[model samples]
Structure formats: structure tokens, C-alpha cells
Target: MSAAADPAAATGPRALAHPGREEIRIEDVLHALADPVRLRIVRRLSGAGEGQACSRFDLPVSKSTSTHHFRVLRESGVIHQIYRGTAKVSCLRQEDLDALFPGLLDSVLRAADHQARRLGEDGHVQRTDG
Candidate 1:
């Protein structure tokens, strides 16, 4: 049978390039998250329990710009992407990130939340009290 017809060749999604966990760098990760758009993407992915399809985000930019943001995130190892059928699903590399930079992700998210609340952008301030 041809490769296309082979059962083994029919994996869930075609492989996409990503930096290995050990290959991730702090500077790259920070840079990737520096952009407002990318930061928003990361924030949304953090709350997405089962990850999210690329199309789900309603970014203000054009499609090409959106693609660029995702690419930066993927390359910097801030997020992981996999092809699910024709769509690319993305999720934060929380485990890897926490391992590499303890408390970093949480701190960033908390700061973002604080700023969001302070600016009244989302009008939702996460409570820190136990």
C-alpha cells in the first residue's frame, strides 16, 4: 500500500516543529510574550482547559499577523502547537515553563490580571485572597 494508505502514516496530526524543552531560552520566551497580541494569546490559552484551535482567538490583527504571533510563541517554546485535522491547536507549555522558570508563568499571569483590572479592560480582577 502507498504511504498515504498506510495505517501508521495516519497519525492524529502532521508533525510541527517546536523547540525541545531543553532548547528553550529565557530571553526568547520573554520576547515572545512581550508583544501585546502574543500576551493576550498566552492569557487566553492559560484559561483554555483543553487547549484551543488557532481560529478561536479573535485577534484584532489580520490573519497573516496572527500567524506571525503564533509562530513566535511556538518558536520561543512558550506554547505548543499541533495540527488537528486542518486546524492548528495551541496550548501553553505550562509544565515545561514552570520547570524551567519556577513561578514565572504564574507571576506574569498575575501581573497581567492586575493590569487588566487596573485598566478596567476586562473588568474582571481575579481575587488573590484565599
Candidate 2:
């Protein structure tokens, strides 16, 4: 294993790649958001006003699987990830998404919340009244 072959040796531990706002496609965003794991990641990021580190998520999937999900989100332009110190932090590309597709992000998030409550997923308490 040569140092040149190692990306960390060249750049950093992890070289995060994210799609530019202009490159973001609705199809790509929808495709990335369709997955349960990815949706959970987005939902959490939405609630978090500030960026969250990759280590903060206690997902049911394995570490590698979690990494894959994050990659999908970043590549689709649904999220922007950066290396903050040694930790890679992520946050939703809400402003960019909104600018490109008006109300799309909020609608998807609302729909996700409604579905979660409806199906009692993710500890979302289903209401019986009203």
C-alpha cells in the first residue's frame, strides 16, 4: 500500500463529495430520499438546526451501510457534507433545494412526518384523537 494510493494521505481521512446546487435533479433527490435509511437521515438533519456529525446518528444499519446512505444523500445534492476537524458533518441542502424546486423539500418532510405518525414508525406517536 503506497502513500500515494491512499486518499487520506493525499487529501484527508475522508474526501467528501457533494453535488452543486445547479446539478441537483429532482429525480436524483427523490431517488435518494426514497430509501428508508436515507429518509431517516434527512428527517433528523431537518430537525437539527446545525450540522450533525456522521457519528451522531445511531442508525440500525452497519457503519458501512450508514456511510453509503450518506454518500447517496450528498451525491444527490440533498445534503452537504464537510470534514469539520476529524469528524464529517452533514446538513440538508434545504435552501438550495427550495430555490430550485419550490416547496418540494418541505412537502417531502411533511409527508414523511405524516407517514411516520400514520405507521407509527420512528417512535412517532400516532394520534387517535382528531
Candidate 3:
């Protein structure tokens, strides 16, 4: 075999990667949720118990941008992606997240909702719970 024909050289050794039980670090998850678009995506996702299709979610962004956001979510382990026919379905990694950080996702989503309400009210809301 010619030196240039070596498959190993074409594709280096496969780096160690998690199969299905991949653990997403807290920092990565937080970073993923930090973006407004991604946060909104997550909020809509967590609101529904069932997996949502890529096109079903109403995002105020272009299709390419939406696809990029979804990719980040999936890479950060905040969401799971599975091919459903020709469409891609995404759902929150609930069990994995719960096992890693209890109540983290819930609190973040609640905080986001609270913030949105505050913004909607022109930064005025009766301070009830912190």
C-alpha cells in the first residue's frame, strides 16, 4: 500500500468519546443556556414533555440560525437529538441532568420566565419570591 493510501493517516485515531452516557459539564451547560435564543429554545422544550420537531418550535430566527442553536444545545448535552423520518426531534436530557445537578434546569427555566414577565411589565413586578 502506498504511504498516502494509509487509512490511519487519513483519519487519525478516534479520540475517546462518550457513547450514550455522555456527561455534560456544568459550565458547558450554563454557557449553552446563557444565550437568549438558546435559553428560549430550552424553555419551550422543557415546557413540553414530548420531543419537539425542529420546525415545530416557533423561533424568531432564520432556519439556519435555529439549526445552529439546536446544534449547540445537542453538543452541550442540554438536549438529545434523534432522527424522526426526515425531521430531527429534540428533547431535554432530563434524567441525565437530574442525576447530575438536581433542580438546576427547573430553577433556570423559572428564573427566565420570571425575567421575561418582568421585562413584559416594564421592569415592574411585585417582588414576591427570590
The number of the candidate with the highest TM-score is 1
lDDT digits (tens) for residues 1-72 of candidate 1: 321223553355486677877898999999998898999999999998766999999999999999999999
In candidate 2, position 23 carries an lDDT of 82
Candidate 3 lDDT by residue in tens digits, 1-130: 3212224423434311221334578888999899988998899888888789989988889999999899888778788766656777777777777767899998999999989987673546656586
Model 3 regions lying over 4 Å from their true place: 1-22, 121-130
Runs of candidate 1 with Cα error greater than 4 angstroms are 1-13, 122-130
Model 1 error, position 61 (Å): 0.4
Instruction: List clashing residue pairs in candidate 2.
Output: none
Query: Can you give the lDDT of residue 78 in candidate 2?
Result: 90
TM-score-superior candidate, 2 or 3: 2
RMSD of 3: 10.0
TM-score of each: 0.83, 0.82, 0.75
| Every candidate's CA RMSD | 7.1, 7.1, 10.0
